[model samples]
Target: MKPGPVIRIDFRGGIVSPGDLYNILVAAGRLGLRRASFGLRQQMFLEVDDSIRNALCVELDALGIDYVNNLEGFPNIVSSFPAEEIFITRSWLSEGVYKDIFDAFDFRPRLKVNISDANQSFTPMLTGNINWVAAPGSPHYWHCFIRFPKTNIIYEAPVCAYTNDLASITACLEDQLMKGEMNGDALFGHPAMAHYLWKKAEAHLELPPFNLPYYEGLNRYGNKNWLGIYTREEWLSIDFLKSICRLCLETRIGQFCITPWKSIMIKSIEDADRPRWNALLDQFRINMRHAANELNFQVEDQNPDALALKIFLLKKLNRDDIRTFGICFGIKTRPRSEVFCNILIRRRAMIRLGRWSFWYRYDICCSEEFNPNKRTAWVFSRNNPRWLLPEQLRRAIIAYYDGKSIAASQQVEQSNRQPDKTAVQQIHQCGECLSVYDDPETSFGDLPAQYQCAVCDAPKDAFVPREWEKQSA
Candidate 1:
């Protein structure tokens, strides 16, 4: 049978720990997963030294892993804006966002021109093959371009263009598609969309030029970021040497697809008694899907330029992790407005996969050092104390590890329990000599009392409270 669809994983945001890589490898072995892909983030800043690169080669060599030089999968190009503007968009925009609707249309077969100022009207550049998708919000401008083999550019000057509707947009696109000749060099928003359009041509679909399969496999199991996010989720466990194994025995589907941060396992693993590890895997999957869906939820083709702009804004805010742009260039340098058609056709290139793939090796070797905001120094700095950053997190960890609330002081605890003081009093007297105490009721040899220092085996009396300990009882 065919190897199924390609499986890709993002290493930067997902794989953060060594154990993460081990678990994924184990899972791959159990499932017979032979190929997968990994995405790298932060290409410009992270540099992989020879030693670290050698270490990576050794690890991949030992495990028999293959990789690709596909970057973070962001197509960083803008159709309507100047080349300089695209870079500005990147620097100002976060990872995954679009600048405007023109960007979305730029990826299409046509370029639209607006004539708000009569003095700055574009040289008419349209052919029977060219078309336009009128700007949805500001109809005063037309937003499409088409051309003939070698003729004066056909111009579709808008006289109060704002009233154009969907019918007009559809007509323009259809007119361009019908014409046997149009600019082939312009970039489109989604390659898939372009492919779909090309396929619309009965003959074009039948006589396609591409020969290779559309998808490629990527092996990304056993990545570090995956471990940081999920320590020992059983559904992710590897049981055998050639396949990925899962703890989801009850899953109706026998197989699953997992990325560094996301796991697409069989539906049956959702049972309540499936063990902590299995449940943990399910929870992780739940969170991953929720996050991806939320980010892409608002993305739509309508008013693409505005949508792209919103996306750009989100990326700048660090709200979205994957951004795409369509590249396009112009024939003439000046009369920026006049160059839309020629520019769209010549300067357009889609950057689906970018520097992320090339830099992944560096990312894996030292993610902590590369991610500035995540570096230990930044997190623990006086200005940004880790403990105080989020109050709920402090409480949650404490709740998980018994009632030892991180925010509560020992002295405060003693005073709060004055009403039911007997239990406190018993522990206080023994606190000094107790190397450790478990509930005094613990069976004699089940495990020694944890009341004393496990390392030095010293009596509790020898323990001096650190500043964080507050006043002694």
Candidate 2:
């Protein structure tokens, strides 16, 4: 967004998949885009063997592309160093580690270093020989650290998850803002995160929302069916970049980057059933708005989808009337089901349900492959496989505690109200599955937390205890 003919392409490994790279080259040739850079990740380096790298090098050479390579992977060497020696050793070994990683990739293009972790003091050593992509901790104020002018340093949003700490993130943003350098930053990570960062950058720059779809339409069909959304044209515009960089500096999570080809691929996949995708999104947005109104909580701009999901989940799981609903509509993944279950458990909405609490049940089911019956409630305990994010697990637990508090309050409030004797008698006469309540003297609290379904007793955790208040008292 800043200006004319600066280096492009921070070739993150995911972006450089063989097919994707080929497409990028073909597109670049058509556009007459000369000179670009490659930023490869450690995982990507491992994934790409010699043949692919050599092939890529040949393609770039043929296209007259001069590249800057920053391939990085290390064993976290400083963790084992003595306190006094940590900084110095890190300063020295980090460059070599960068070199080692870069050397591993078979491409013979020019190499440089882009240090992701700013806390480490390795930027100075790697700066002179190669390009330095700045995050929060980079120090290259006086001179062009990578032998270029202000344009050499590539700015990116503070790393996600870790960037949640506002003080540090703000400090980083202030530094980049003060520099007033024209070069842009790579908002690397997930699509959601990338979009969040883009908005954040905009806020920092005091600009308006860049309607991305106006310039480069998304689909190959060129917006024929109102399906394609223009994204890159928006990204390439200076006004848009400035605004996004400013906004991304504030918060964490939901930031990501995807290759152009990958974006195209996703469009192709969605285009197969565009109406269905659009409808689902529209329904989700409506549900979210309704839930937010009910809860009196504003959804975060960065995570509306997640917030919407939570609202729908609360509505569905906490309902006492409905018995069964599919977690993942068309997907067959067990983890998705487990994640839904975890959300319910953490919200603390599953109280005294028939066998296995919902969370436990989901954990067990997701951990293994079992045929799910549409009409039957399947309950499980202690056998679920955990996910990669510990934070997710923690959230589930917190939600459970919160839900419990709400439920306890409701119970206490109900107890404070007195009902007419005749009305109570009429309520007690209700009989549809009364045989299941064989022990009338047992308080509802005494009922097992786990239970089978009303009709089939297929082990389930969907229903709560009913009646028996006197016994509980």
Candidate 3:
């Protein structure tokens, strides 16, 4: 969509108070905005009529609302709270823990951050510059990983950050990076965040492989119910939002969560209130159950071309019954913006067709070993036209399975060995840790000379082609 008079409201940690959201909705509804959207970072996206843009701004100001006009600067803190109860796991991480961490922040952060469960594939682990992942510890700990600004270099810190120190460490890191202290590996010893550090952090966090849960529709959670809402167009009606907010207020539901998937989850709906929720959905003709594949897409916020391309590719994939069960697709038309996906479609260059028309060529890449949490993306095909995406993406998927099969194969034989034709695939493994370069198609000679185990940071020569068996959904 074309940019107009726009304002973005940050809902820190994807957690929103019902009343706060309701008030904003009322303000927007009164100002002629019947539609809105949520961003991948869990912020609210609003477009005001150019003539009354300032008027909306005035109303927000009176209501003590803070908003920005563009995608640059002031990144929101992202957390896996949306998946907390729905994808519940036995861990020290709890709702109170999340709330405490949020409360510890004395000031808004200037950097993107992710506080996510290490075992959950529903939320990304490395999409932020400052990532505090759930780690094993008695006092509760988070493994801090930092991605340097304007660069692809992501590194591990020397110490794990205690829960109480997350805020101080975050603010300190932001301050230091602002002063051109871009060394991620050295940040642990910085005086600003030194004392807050605890035990030495593990060199790598072996995350669960990508497997997105079906996060839509009314679902049973204990005695209560949680309803997840998503719109294919992503343009949610203000009336719909307000209706849900009102229900939440009436039912005494304290809060709701907006996900990085650009959807909302309203939890703790009483069983008695189920009919009311169903009636509300019926009244608005909302369908919460979307096809599994339809729910796995991430488009650049409010990008028409990206959405269009998504629609086109989906049609082809569905028609062919393409299997994309374990993968997430991210479409990017904007340069240098982070996306959470196993398969990435990026706009490389545009070709002008007329004074007002143009066509874009794309580049395709996938995460290392098809692991969505890794920041590393290995290029497959580049400079592909729009029409070639479905085919190219299918081939990439095929490559993933082929590599997977090869990795499950037995160890290479002594002479001119090929991967064993067993049920498993065999790939390269690091001598120091469990990290493996699981791409069998890519020759060893073609691997980057400086490439090392992302987990152990062992030299490239430390990796040898090997076989292993692992099971996943």
Which candidate comes out best when scored by lDDT? 3
What would the per-residue lDDT of candidate 1 be over residues 216-253, giving only the tens digit for each residue? Answer: 11212222001112111112223221122333332322
Q: What's the distance in Å from true for residue 442, model 1? A: 81
**Model 3: CA > 4 A from native:** 137-139, 350-357, 410-473
lDDT of candidate 2 at residue 265, scale 0 to 100: 14
lDDT comparing candidate 3 with the true structure: 0.80
Better of 1 and 2 by TM-score: 1
Judged by TM-score relative to the true structure, which candidate is superior, 2 or 3? Answer: 3
TM-score of each: 0.21, 0.20, 0.85
Worst 10 residues of 2 by lDDT: 75-84
lDDT-sorted candidate list, best first: 3, 2, 1
Best by TM-score: 3
| Model 2 regions lying over 4 Å from their true place | 1-47, 61-473
Once fitted onto the true fold, the runs of candidate 1 whose alpha carbons sit more than 4 angstroms away are: 1-50, 68-254, 258-278, 282-293, 297-473
